[model samples]
Target: MNVLVIGGTGTTGSLLAKLLPHARVGTRKPVRDGQVRFDWDVPATFGTALDGVDRVYLIPPVGVADPAPVVESFLVRARLVRRVVLLSSSAVPESATGMGALPALVRTMPEWAVLRPSWFMQNFTGDHAVAAGVRDGEIVTATGDGRIGFVDAADIAAVAARALTDPLPHNTDHLITGPEALSYADAAAIITELTGRPVAHRSVSTEELTGRLATWLPPEFAVILAKLDEDIRGGAEDRVTSTVLDVTGRPPRSFRDFFRGFLS
Candidate 1:
C-alpha cells in the first residue's frame, strides 16, 4: 500500500513515515530528491501527490484558524483512497477548536481512525516554546496545578501506522495518552534532576499568555491556545488512556523516561 504521509518531516509525521515500508513523505520545502510536494495551503499541489495513494495520514494546516475547508477539499478528490488517519489534539473539544469537526470528516469514508493525542513529550526536547522556557530556567503556563498526560510522538506514530495498515479500521476516535499524568511542576522537577537546571513552572493569566502568544501566533489561534491552557487548568488533560497500548501493543513512554534518555 502506498501510504502518503503529510507533514512527513515533522515530529509524528516523520516518525510515521520512517515506520512505513512503502511511504511517500510529503514536505513543503525541497529537502531532498523524491520528497513529495505537499502544502495544505496550496490546493493545486494536492492532486499530483495524492494520485495512486492507497491510504493517507492527514495533517491539517498549521496556524490556520480553520482547516476544515482545506481538508474537506482534499478529501473530496481523495475519495478513491481506501483509508485516512488524522492527527488531532486531546484538548480540542474543551477548547472547541476546528479539530472537533474532524472526526465527522474522517467518518465520511468506510475505514478511518482519528488519533487525539495529548501534549507531546517532545515539547521539551524539541525546539518548541516550552523547551525554550525550560532552557531559560522557567516554564510559564496558565494551567495552574492541573496535570497532563503527555505522550511521546513515537508512540503516536506507531499507533498511526497500525491504524493505516489494519485490514479493518478501529472505526472510532482514540484518545491516545501517556501511562501517567504529571503536573508542570512534576515535569520541571524531572528536568531539574536530568539537566541540573532549576527550571520552575510559573503561573500566569490566560489573557497574559494569549497576548504574548499573539506576538508570534495569529490572534485567533493565540486565543485558542490560551483557551486550551485554561482547559488544562480545569483538568481536561489529566486522565491517562490505554489507546496507545491498545493500538501499538505497548504502553506509552513516560515523561521522566523521555527526559532521562534525551538529556543523558
Candidate 2:
C-alpha cells in the first residue's frame, strides 16, 4: 500500500522510509522520488502529500502545544487513506494536560493507532543532549535521579510500519517502552563506558535549567520540559511495558544493547 510519512527526514521517519520503499515520504524541503514536499504548518500542501496515499505515518511537528487542529485538517484531507499511525509521547497521557487532543482526533479516523513511546534513545545520540555532550563531554538536564524507559526510535518506526501496513485494530494506543528503565546517572555511566571518556550527567534545578534552555527552546516549552523532567524523577516512566513484545512479537531492545550498537 502507498503510504505518506510526515517528517520523513527525521529519526523515526528516516527509518520508516528505509523500511518501506514504496511509501511516499513528506518533507518541507525537496526530496527524491516516493517523497513529496509537505509541511504541517502549511495547509495548502496537505492535498499533494495525501493524494493516492493509502496510509499515513503521522508525526506532528515537535513542541506543538495544540495539534488537534493540524491532525484534524490532515484527516479531512486524507479521506481515502485507510489507516493513520500517529507518533505520540508517553509523557503526555490521553487525559493529561496538553496531550489528549491529537490522539483524540486520530481515534475518529476509520482505522488509527497512536504510538505513545517513551523518551527516545536517539535524543542523546541524534538530537540534543548526547551529541552535544559527545562534543563537549558534558550532558546536562533537570532530571534528578529520574529513571526513564528510553526506547529506540527504530523500534518505534517498526511498530508504526506495522500499524500502517498491517490490519491493525482501530483506535488503539500502544504505550511502547524500552526493555528496562535507567536514570540519567545510569545512562551517563553507560556512555562513559562506551566512549571511554569522563562524560557526566549534571543535574540542574528546574528554574535554572528552564532559564538555560530558554535560549534554545521557547519559554513555554522550556517550562513544560522542566515539568516533564520532574515527572520523570517522580518515576512516571520507570516501568517497562509488554506492548513492544505484544505488538512486534519480540523483546524490546535494552538500553545497554542500544548503546553498544549505536553509541560505541
**TM-score, one value per model:** 0.96, 0.94
Predicted candidate 1 versus true structure: per-residue lDDT over 65-143, tens digit per residue: 7778788889998967889999988887722347677777878877898889999999987887789989899999899
Q: Relative to the unseen true structure, what is the C-alpha lDDT of residue 158 in candidate 1, on a scale of 0 to 100?
A: 95
Query: Where does candidate 1 have its weakest 10-residue lDDT segment?
Result: 94-103
Instruction: For residue 174, give model 1's deviation from the true position in Å.
Output: 1.0
lDDT of each: 0.87, 0.84
| Backbone clash tally (model 2) | 0
- Compose the digit string of candidate 2's lDDT tens values, residues 1-264: 789999999999999889898888899995587779998789999999998988889898778776777777788888898788888889986753355677887787888899999999987787685568755778888788888989998888888878887765546888999988898889888888887887788888889888987898889988888888878878898878888788778888888888799854
Runs of candidate 2 with Cα error greater than 4 angstroms are: 95-97
